[model samples]
Target: MALIDDTRAILGDLIAFPTVSRDSNLELIAYAADRLGAAGARVHIQTDETGHKANLVASLGPETGGGVVLSGHSDVVPVEDQDWSSDPFELREEKGQLFGRGTCDMKGFIAATMAMAPHLGDLDLSRPVHICLTHDEEVGCLGARRLVEEIAGWDEKPSLAIIGEPTEMRIVEGHKGCCEYTTVFTGLEGHGSRPELGVNAVEYAVRYVTRLMELREMLKGRAPAQSRFEPPWSTLQVGRLAGGVAHNVIPGHASVDWELRPVSDADHRFVCEAIAAYARDDLLPAMREISADADIVTHVIGEVSGLEPVDDNEARRIVSALTGANGADVVAFGTEAGLFQKLGMSVVVCGPGSIAQAHKPDEFIEISQLSACLDMLQGLAGKLSTAR
Candidate 1:
């Protein structure tokens, strides 16, 4: 059978599962496990605490050190508020594109890996080719961390990993780290008639927001002049804010959810410490004047660490060879690549569609793009066959 045939079939099946981050992906995990097992690979599943979501790892070839990993997430973003012509879980083909929720962002890559299964069965690989699929990638790359932890304990860890996020098949060697935080401010509430008698939580929140803005500017100004990233700099944004319920009363509490995208891990910590300092020195004392219980609480929503490009590693050479690109570049978005990198793998981000189509109402991957991805995976298989 043709590679495209298997990939499309698998893509159809994968999209059928509503593997939204908030939902369990056990169904999808089971389906993947079956496919991998049938393909003559050794499959192992790591489930979350509730045993609802799962991370599936399958290996083709020897169990010893040094191999390649084809990694992707099983979760898709929600389609609730989006307007779509068809159900998000159902694949729709039109004008040489496959329309579906996860097609581009990216069940397509998972399908491509599955398409390599038959070829893998035929190959006598000395170095294993491991396929790592995880859930909750959309929810801050959560599942991959645990999956990486599992991979770290393997008898022979894969030397390189390819994170199959949408990149039109170009090799992405680096990306920014994202750190999300939710902060809550507390104050004593009093009637609006005597504002001085109570601390206004909303007012403190504004100050906190203002301080964050200043920090954002400071970080932006310190960004290096050279970068392959789109914006080429770190960024910060306040995503949500909630507080008061009535106009005549001071809000006892206010909360803000914000995030920072840093160019490196060190930069991420620096920003976190900066926020912590601001809450302690500037906001807390003023709040305590109104009530001893008044305070600001800051906690991490989640963080995706950045990947720094490796210099002429085997992984880079393989990706460049597969994509036929003169060079690889870095992205501004966060990805699961850093986690694999944390496991001592030289990782790159390269896959089928454009990220522009991701998380949109009408998500899709071009037929040609899917074909290209199959070629890449197939090409990798050939490389392994020879390298072994």
Candidate 2:
């Protein structure tokens, strides 16, 4: 009960910082570092090239190998343009639920971890319990990459990682990988009425989008071998598009931002290669015919690779065992689990709220859900203690 009280206030403080992915999260990171340090964990910070965003890692228990690492992102999605009943940054308790922008999306998990730091320090363990928190997870799992690289250098890597990504406390073993790209098509511009005089970049972009749709259908038909996922297959869609100026001009520029979520690792590269081939052989040459300067440019924005837990992975097994779930399920939404998994640590996704509530206005996590998660976290600490 004390932990819950402490967690609620910590989450409120965290929510107030407004650590949006687009903004620097150093304030939040520093707060976490200070807390963990005071609780007697050796804290380390990993910063991006710009030194703006950061990922913080800390450890309790023994400094040796083979303990659990609890991980979560410190960043929240932007609250701008979202309709909310109250100030999105302020945490509100209403009818046994905590309402805030990142309360469900993830600051809640981070709060739980911080609150547990004291208990973890009190426990005597055979192996170290590491805490890994990162920024830019809502953007693309970028900060986790830096954190993973740091973990790799350690003499003793954690045996498993639990990424608390608001999965309603279910053990999640897999999810689709997401890759986003911005494609720009440049063509010759001329008078709109002089049809043959210039290349219409917008028209060419339409062709590219149509091609993308066809490819999407092709991928949709190839069912993934797993039944855990909802669609059980890969998917693609165009998220944003921009082009042209006025009705009177043949616009020379068009750009479409699109993304693909592949069911597996092999599927991700296959889809990327296919898109590149289509750009090279189909769209580029035709656009070039109108003007030598015509070109199609593809820029990768961010990617969250599909997580594939190793057979009987400790992370997956332990979370499933603790939650009384027989098997782990896959989710359609991406998480930071894949990045942690790539660090030679078996990873599982399990956390407090439903993904359904994430990113929506009036987002909340039930008090019961928070209570359940704390119970599980305490249970996990007990498991680690006994194993030692």
Candidate 3:
């Protein structure tokens, strides 16, 4: 079959699984593993704690050293409440665009790579080529973190990793880190009639949230003079908050779900430490004055480190040579690239489609983009076929 047809067939199979982040992605993993295994590649599967999800690492050619890793996530975001013209799990094409959940955000790249698998064995390669599909990346890069730890223990590691996130086929060198957290406040409740008798948890929660906003501004002021990020600063925001039962009573419990996107690890550490200090020395002390039992607790739910630009990056150079681009770009979104970079591999983000189309109603990827990606991968295969 032609590359386009093969890619579409594989992409359709991937979309049919409905591997949402909330659900198990073993089905998708199994399909990928089967295809890679049939292609004469050595496939390794790593199961997560629940054993319901897994990551697959498949390699073609010799496994000694100096290989390129094409990595993408198997799981996608939820399609709930999104109004689509057709079934989100069914790949539909109209006017040269393929519509489906995960089509743009990911699976397209995976499909293209799988389409190349049948031809890999025919190449006269000096180095190996690896295809790595991970789970739960939409949640917090969970599977990639585990996979990276496993890779760290390997005797042989890839020279470069290219994360197939939606980058419109451009080379992306950097992205900010994301940290998600929740703060819960517990206080004494009483009737609204006695204003001074009760410690209102909702009120304290608001105060804490207000402090977070102030810190957000402070972070804005701390942006590095030469920062390349679009906003040129860290960002903090509260996404969800709830607590009160009745207007006539003082609520005893409240919670806030918030997140931080930092350009640097120092910024991340600063904001986290500042928040903890505020809760301990400023907010919690005031809350406890009303009632000794009053307490504020913060828990970090997720963290994906930012990808910082590095000097002499082989992944960037290879992508630039393939795409014929002069420079790389930066994105506001996070990816598993940083985790791979932490494992001492040169990492770059380059893939088909636009991120603007990702995680939205009627998400889609242009057929032209997929064709371009196939061409790029073919170029990579040609490069790998010759001895370096």
Candidate 4:
């Protein structure tokens, strides 16, 4: 069968799994593992503490140096309120597009890798090819974090990790880190008539937000020279702030939902340290003086590392050659490529579709895009072939 046909067929089967970020992806993992294992590739499944979700790592050819990883998230965003023309879990083909929930965001790349499974043994490869399918990427890149820990333990490390994010098959060199947090304030409630008698949680939350804005402005000055990202700065936003039950009552509780998209690790650290010092030295002392029980807590939703663009990136170079791209670009969105890059592997984000279609109603990847991705993979095989 042609690679395109096989990719289409596998993509349909993959879409049928309906592996949303909030749902278990073990079934999908099992299917991929079985397929890779039958193709004489070594397959490993790393399940999180909850066995319901898993990451599949499969490799072909020798397990040693200079191997390349084909990576993609196996989970999709939800279709809860989306108005789709057809069932999101069922793949629908129309006018050269394959419509499904995960089609454009990621599953298309996974299918492209799977389509190459039957021919794994046909080539005498000098360097190996590895496929990594991770769960919970849409949520927080939780699965990739765990999967990288497993990769760290391997004696032989892959030299490159090509993250199959929706990059329109163009090579992407960098993206910002995503860090989300929820800060809660606990204070004593009292009559509004005597504001000094009690600590106002709402007031403190506003102060915290003000501090965030100060840091946000400071980030602009610290932006790396020649940064590729638009606005070219580590960005911050306070998504929500809530407190005060009524005007007459001093609120006992307040919470702030906020996020930081840091362009570099140093920027992330600087923001975190400044916020902690503000809370510890200034805010906490005053609040505690008023009420011994006054306390503030910060909860981390997720802190994904950023992929910084580098001059000596093998993955970018290889992908550029394969795709005939003249230069690499950066994106605002995050991907698990950073996690793999942390392992000292050159990482690049390149895959078949536009992210504009991801997480939207009737998400899709064009058949032409899939065909182009297959051609690139075939080119990669040729590059890695010992026969060359």
* Model 3 lDDT per residue over 143-209, tens place: 9989999988888888899998989999999999999999999988999999588888898889889
Q: Would you list the rank order by lDDT, best first?
A: 4, 3, 1, 2
lDDT for model 4 comes to 0.92
Each candidate's lDDT (Cα)?
0.87, 0.85, 0.91, 0.92
Q: Which stretches of candidate 4 lie over 4 Å from their true place?
A: none
Residues 106-139 of candidate 4: C-alpha lDDT, one tens digit per residue: 9999999999966865788898888999999988
Q: Single out the weakest 10-residue window by summed lDDT for candidate 3.
A: 379-388
Error of 4 at 325 (Å): 1.0
lDDT of 1 by residue, 1-388 (tens): 6778888888999999989899999999899989889999999999889888889988889888888889999999999989999988999999999999999998999998988886897799868888989989888888998988887887777898888999999988888888788998888888999989988999999888998888888887767667666676688899998998799998888999999888877677777888789889878987887699998988777888888876756788888888798888887677999999988888889999999999998899998999998888877888779555
TM-score of each: 0.94, 0.91, 0.93, 0.98
Compare candidates 3 and 4 on lDDT and give the better one.
4
**What value does the lDDT take at residue 47 in candidate 3?**
98
Error of 1 at 130 (Å): 1.2
Backbone clashes under 3 angstroms, per model = 0, 0, 0, 0
Q: How far is candidate 4 from the true structure (C-alpha RMSD, Å)?
A: 1.1
Sorting all predicted structures by TM-score, with the top scorer first, yields 4, 1, 3, 2
The stretch of ten residues in a row with the least summed lDDT in candidate 2 is 220-229
